[model samples]
Target: MSLVSTLIIADDHPLFRSALRTVVAQLLPGVQIVEADSPDALNLAVQEHPRADLILLDLRMPGVQGFSALITLRGQYPAIPVVVVSAVEEPAVMRRALDFGACGFIPKSAGLDTIGEALRSVLEGGVWLPPGVTENAAAEEQEERELAQRISSLTPQQFRVLMMLADGRLNKQIGGDLNVSEATIKAHVTAILRKLGLYRRTQAAVLAQRLLRAESASLAELGSAAEGGAEEEAE
Candidate 1:
C-alpha cells in the first residue's frame, strides 16, 4: 500500500493558500493539505496532526517574527520537514532559511512545476534551493549559524520565555501570559541565557532584534506582495 502524506500549508493569504493546495493536490494525488492562516493556527494544526509529513511556511504570517516561527517549528517538530514558501526570494534569506533547518526554500513567485519539484525533493530527503544559489559561509553567516544552533537547543518552554523577553516583557507579565509564577519565569530566563551563552537578558533581546532586523526588508516586500495578491484576487 502507498503511504499518504499530509502537508501543512501555512500562509496568510487565502488566494495563495488555495493556489498551493491545488498545486499539491495535482502534483501529489491523495495528499492531505491542512491550511493555516497564522502562526498560531499552524501550531494548532501541527498539534492536531502530529504525523504531518511536511510544512510549507510563510515567514511573515501573523504571530511570526521573521524566522522565529521557522526556528520554533524546527526545534519542536524535528521529524517533520519544513519548506519555507515566502515572497522573500533573496539568496541571503534562502541561506538563512536553510541554516535554520528548513529542508527547502520555495519563493512565492516560483512556477507550480518548480514548487512541485522542490516539494518532491524535500520529501525524498534532499535539500532544495533555487537554481544558481550556492551556499557560502561568510563570517557573519557563521556567527548567525552558531546563534541558530544555540537557539535550537532551547526547550519549547524556554524558547517561548526567551521570545517574551526579547519583546521586552517583564517577568511578571510573562508569567501571567504563560499562567506560571514569576519565579518560574525567572528560572526559565536563566536557562535561556545559559543556553544561548549570554550573560545578560539584554543580550538575548539584542540577538532577537538583530535577527528580526535582518529580515525586515524582506518582510516589507512580503507584505507588499500579499497586498498585491489580494488586489489581484479582488479584481
Candidate 2:
C-alpha cells in the first residue's frame, strides 16, 4: 500500500488541477485528493488535512502574492511537504521556492514522466528540481528572505491583516471584512508592524507592495535571461 493517503492540490486552473489529479492517482493508487482553487480554500484544506502527505501549490493564487502563501503553509504546517507546481518556470523562482521551504519545484510545462519523477522523488523524502537547477542555486535577496522570515512568523490571522493593509484598507474596514472588532484589527496591525520591523502601517504597506512587485520583476528578469540563453545557443 502507498504511504501517501491524502494529497492536496492548490492551483487555480481547473484543467491543470485535473491533470495533476490524474497523475497522482496513477502514481499512488487510492490516495485521497483534495482540490483547492483559491487561497482561502487552500487554507481551509490545510486546516482540514493537516496531516496530508503532500501539497502541490501554485504561486499566483487569489488572495496571495509572491511567497506569502508558501511562507504561511510552512509556518503553520511544517511537517507537510509542499511542492510548487507553477507556470513560472524560472530557475530563480524554483530556488526561491526551495528557500521558502518547498520540497520540490515542478514547472507546469513538464511532461508527465518528469512530473512523476519529481513526485516520486519528493514522496521518498528527497528534494527534487528541474534538470540543471542546483540544490544551492542563487536564492532571493537577503532582504527579501529576511522579510519572508518575518512574514512567516506571523499567525495566519496576522498575515491576512497584512494583506488587507497592503490594499490600503482602514482598520475598521479590515475588521468589517474579517468579522472582528476594530480594536482587534488595530492590535493585529500593531503586531504585524512590530514583527516586520516597521513603525507605521504605511511602511508595512510599502514593504508588502515591494514583495508583491518582486515576483513580477523576477518573472521579467527570467524572461530576459532565457532570451539571452536562446540567443547564445543560436550563435
Candidate 3:
C-alpha cells in the first residue's frame, strides 16, 4: 500500500526548487510533487489540484510574492500545511510566517536531513520551527478536530443531507433521491450548516467528505484486521 499524499512546490528559482523536489522524493516517497513556476501558477494549482496534502514553499521567490501566496492559500485550504523553506532566518520573519499559518519554517541553508525531517514531521500531524514561533499548528489541528466533533452531532437527517452534499447532489435532487420533500431537505441542510459552523453549503459539503472518508477508512481497517485474524486462526 502507498500513502497517497500530494505536495506542491512553488518557487521562482528553478535550481533550488528542483533540488527541493529531489530532497522531498528521497524523504517522502509517498508524496506526489507538483511544481509551479510563478505565484500565479502556484495559486491556480492550489485551487485546481484536488487533495494537496502538503506544500513546500520558498519565501524569497521574487517580489516577496511567497508570503502573500502562503496567506491566501492557507485562508482557502487551511487543511493543507505549508512549510517555509527560505534563506531568510531572521527571528521576526520566521515568527511572521508562522503567524500567517505556516506549519513549519526551515532555513534554505538547512541540510537535507533537516528538511526531510521537517516535512515528514508536519505530514505526520506535527509542526516544525527552527527556534521560536508564537503560533502552534498542533493547537490549530486540535481546534479543527473539536469543531469537527461538534459538527458530527448533526441529526440523522442532517447527516444524510450532508452526505448528499458531499456527493455533489443539489437539494432538490437529494430530496428526490432520498424520497424526501425538497423543503425537508432544505431544512436538513440548514441544520447541517449550523452544526458545522459554516455559512455556505459548499463548506459543509467539504467537511462532510472529510468526516465520511475518515469513517470509511476506519471501517476498512477494521475489516482488514478481522480478515487477517481469521486467516491466522485457520493456520
lDDT of each: 0.77, 0.79, 0.65
Model 3, span 1-235: residue lDDT tens: 2254678998888888888899888877757789987777887888877578878887766644324455556656777878888887765456556655678888887888888777777877777877554443344244443453444355555655666686788878998988988887777776655555556666565555654431122111111121122212110
Residue-level lDDT tens digits of model 1 in 81-182: 899999888888887788778889998999889998887788878889988876554664565556566777888888888777768888889999999998
Candidate 1 stretches with Cα past 4 Å from truth are 213-235
Model 2, clash count? 0
TM-score of 2: 0.76
Span of 10 residues, lowest total lDDT, candidate 3? 218-227
Return the top candidate by lDDT: 2
lDDT (C-alpha) at residue 75 in model 2:
76
Return the TM-score for each candidate structure: 0.84, 0.76, 0.53
99-193: candidate 2 lDDT, tens digit per residue: 77899999999999999999999999999999998866554455554555566678888887877777889988999999999988888877776
Ranking by TM-score: 1, 2, 3
lDDT comparing candidate 2 with the true structure: 0.79
Task: Pull out the clashing pairs in model 3.
Answer: none
- Candidate 2 Cα misplacement greater than 4 A, ranges: 40-44, 61-64, 137-140, 218-235
